[model samples]
Target: MRVNKLTIAALAVVAGLSLTACQNDDTAGTGRSDSSSSSKGSHSGGSAQDTAKDSAGNDSGEGQDTAAGTGSAKNGATGKCRTDELEVTAQDGTIGGDEDNTVAVTFTNGGGRDCSIAGFAGVDLKTNAGTVSAERSGEPAPATVLKDGESVSFSVSYPANDTGGSGVRVTGLVVTPPNETKSVTLDWPGAASLPVTDGSGTPVRVGPIGSAGQGS
Candidate 1:
């Protein structure tokens, strides 16, 4: 069969249209795509175009945050920090002169989003006997927004066994992130086993959760 010049021109136009469609699919991420954009034929057809658009949205910053598996709450979307995405730890205890010591509860963001957390983190001191939930300071605090790898901390001050008498051996600690149901567990960081007036109760004072670089 002999091909005419007109037929060649038509095929070239079709090829150009296909390439342009693919590019549009690849670039449409967030904020709603323009209705004016056009797409007719893709090299891999409609399936390819759909996949490209989906990927573009998923790869965007806000998209990654909303879809992140770490349960992180995105800033504008949820405004609550996910518990599972935080790495919680307790630093060594520093004893204040008044028979009380401060333990630092550090929270690091290990996810992809900027999240906000506030108030007193649920703290519990655990022993073989039972669990003692922490009391809130009842003071309001500004929500701390954290980016990836950013951290926030709070202080828990408890009475030290100054009398050096028989004291209960502290075994475990439980920490809950703000507005999250999940909690983080850590080992007791007491200079020695904490002493209590009685094994049944321990008076623990906790500070409000604050942003990184702020004194807890």
Candidate 2:
């Protein structure tokens, strides 16, 4: 009986040793797997951060481009200047014969910078047929100044005269600023006949005008 008991005890010791070995192998394998998973997670986080930084850079670049484009339109008609902001318009019922054709020449400074109206002059009247040429017969309008984004105008008068028998009246308008000269023709299809006949039996006033829309 004692010998049998000893053999059974040895067999139980061997079984316990085998179980310990298996447990140690399982723990080592689990540790290796955990370490690999941690490394992969670290690499993924670094890649995400890099992507975020790249996206932010692209956005900043786009913003800069947009601002540059807007600035250009404000200075040049296409990208930087407000070229169309300045213009001229004539008043209604302001044109007639014998009476001062009260006209207004308007100027607008579309540039970001301010500008001034130095002075203005009226050009002589010319005919399409080239038969007649009128002299600077009347007084010119006075000098005027303008501010940035601001506008102003003055009045002009035309006398009543027979437009050289051709019956066509054409007048030239010229406005001279410190930096530029603007000209435009004021066309009257037919010169209004003067109420009184002149000494030469020709109509006294009325003619076509050429425009000098030249500006600096």
Give candidates' CA RMSD values in order: 20.1, 11.8
Kindly list the per-residue Cα lDDT of model 1 for residues 1-216, writing each as its tens digit.
Answer: 256888988999999999999888777752244433434334348888789898887689676676784565322364567887888989855744444677888988887767777788888988755676767655667777788899888887776676776665678889988777888889988655566655464477677887222323
Give me candidate 2's TM-score against the actual structure.
Answer: 0.40
Cα error of candidate 1 at position 57, Å? 23
Tens digits of per-residue lDDT for model 2, 11-94:
999999999999999999999999999999999999999999999999999999999998886675322112243454433224
Q: TM-score each candidate.
A: 0.59, 0.40
Deviation (Å) of 157 in candidate 2: 13
Instruction: Report every candidate's CA lDDT.
Output: 0.73, 0.48
- Candidate 1 off by > 4 Å: 1-78, 93-99, 198-202, 211-216
Q: How accurate is candidate 1 locally (lDDT)?
A: 0.73
Window of ten residues with lowest summed lDDT in model 2: 207-216
